[model samples]
Target: MHKTNFAALALLSAACLTGMSSAATPAQKGFITGTVVNEQGKPLPGVEIDVDNTLSYDSSLITYTDAKGQYRVDVRKLPFTFQVYAKMKLKYGDSTVNVELVPNNPDAVAGLAGGVRDFVFKPKPVTAEDPYGNLGRVFVERGIGEYDVDTAQVQVTLTPVGTLADGSAGKARTFKLLPSGGGPVIPNVMWGKYQVTATLNGKALQIRQRTDGRTPATWGAAYTGGFTRDYNALTPSMFLEVRVPRAGD
Candidate 1:
């Protein structure tokens, strides 16, 4: 017994000299808290909070906002390098998207050391610099490649069906799709239903809303735009497909 004890003691001493420890370093305690609100500053409850450790394979910490639109998640600040980033997970139709929340402070997530990262669903108009930063975008995906019609002579009209999401009245608008240029894009339309129609060479062409995977036979019929909700943008968009009609009444 004495000989075995001495051998173990020598081994422990050797390990100490080699700077090795038998126990893992305890994880540091850290937390992230935030609030989610809408454009009108109204609290948005049930918003999902996702906290991830970038350098480690540790499972992410997930939580949701309370009735007061507040959420808090505890994090394990591991040794060596600990980085915790956070985002808001939102559900859109059948898809979910992650939107980055702005950290209250610049290096706030260094160790997940108790920082506030708030998210606000603010819908802004689409600008040249930020085309996708708006309430919604209605795009004519195909005007030239799919058909033999001259895109320069193709005109698409959008007639608003109701009040827009921004509480503003909508107006009918028309745009000429150009083949040589970037396809026609209604970049600044707020989220709402619209009657979409197109004309090629002064002849009305059939239109379809392919955003939600409509049937192939539905392609050659007048289509009312069905926008796809984007959880990240807190808005919706429509990707319209158009085709020339065949011989019939």
Candidate 2:
């Protein structure tokens, strides 16, 4: 009778252990699926699609689209926000989309099959010229063979080359190139010889120009003196600096 009771207690302990094991198992994983379509509503094949897991500070996950413009990203049960980007070739440009994944809401995912959805992409618009009424203007033309200077392409920065009246070098100013013809304008510059440097990618190219009281009010005025050197050999980070004197100062 004691042996029988010991066996029964051992069986109960085993059952409890099994239950604990089952409870300790991790939750089922979740997935993000989507289709990529172009402006004409056609499935774009060979287009590079990138899915970036934005929820975590590390940005730990990434995936690409398949032949049918379909993509899937499998992740643990945790909720996350993802940034999707589609790029076709080099010149055609790229597009972006944002999505949030929530596995806890059954009703929110009821309509999805395999947690998949369709995404449409459109090209980004060009940036407008600077509207500040500064007296001096700086013009930066996007180099050839480069598309969309605003992001993921090329960046521009501007700085005063000489020293200020206080015998200290002035702070450097940065301006980014836009698809449109206009960019930032440096106004009220004291009339003096100044040099403007254009940095593309990270390389520097110097351009010498004089900014006087006669500087135009339009954004294109920044390019008045034109680049002294050829820009063909310069990289995206290369820069040109223009020298100018303020109108009356």
Candidate 3:
């Protein structure tokens, strides 16, 4: 029994010295670090970052920005080189969207070589090529059991309540809803609070934000999934529900 144990130990030592064992060398490692900042060049803290290592078994790691808007991720360096990329989760009002972050240091996209890779939230103009525009989607709905009218003629207005995310004074907008029943989505609008109002054929309609899952009264109306469903930032982005209110309230 003693001889057998000694022989096995000797064999393991020989294997390691000959580089024939997995434990012969430790896995190499490198790190990636960066800071997140807003478009105005102010540091943005508490931002979640995803560091993806493409073409490697060790695929990804997650990190968040500190109070100083800085983050770091340790990555294992494999013999075969692979590209590394970073992504970020950004908040627009009550909604959140994932953006593929472009690093200021372009070389960071290549194999890991410890360096600074900063990110800035500089939104570009919405174009056909970029469907994920900087705008937010607001779902508009006419309350059930409400008076019927032509949606095309309904004039909807959105008045900004305060300064926009970029600290610019927001402008009021008015638009007509889609007539084909395809979309209640308000077009070309930024994500923020808005005082919504609507007029149908010169008659005012009662408006409320159903973002809290509160539904207007539907006399004897039945829904498949019931009338209430909780949503983050209403549904997807925000919801503006309008209905003709009965008199004497």
Compute each candidate's TM-score over C-alphas: 0.49, 0.31, 0.47
Error in Å for residue 55 of model 2: 3.8
Q: Evaluate all candidate structures by whole-model CA lDDT and list the values in order.
A: 0.56, 0.37, 0.52
Better of 1 and 3 by TM-score: 1
Q: What range of 10 consecutive residues in model 1 has the weakest lDDT sum?
A: 1-10
Give per-residue CA lDDT, model 1, range 1-249, as digits (tens).
Answer: 011122343355344424422112222346566667764667777776766656657655678889987776665453223233435555434545454442332243545345556655543323334545334566675533565765556678787777755455668777654231234555545566788888887788878765343445366556775577532334566777676887783
Order of candidate numbers by TM-score, starting with the best: 1, 3, 2
In candidate 3, list every pair of residues with a backbone clash: none
Question: What is candidate 3's CA lDDT for residue 49?
Answer: 73
Off by over 4 Å in 3: 1-34, 55-58, 66-108, 113-117, 122-136, 142-155, 162-183, 187-193, 199-236, 242-249
lDDT of 3 by residue, 147-243 (tens): 5845555677676777654456677666665322324645335555666677788787776564344545332111111111135432234555676
Per-prediction tally of clashes: 0, 35, 0
**Residue 191 lDDT in model 3?**
54
TM-score of 2: 0.31
Candidate 1 — what's its lDDT?
0.56
lDDT of 2 by residue, 1-249 (tens): 011122343356345434433221123236655556654556655555455555446564456667776666664454655554544442101212122221111122211122444444432211133222112233444333334333322333444445532134645445543332233332222212233444445544323333233653222223322122123311111223332223442
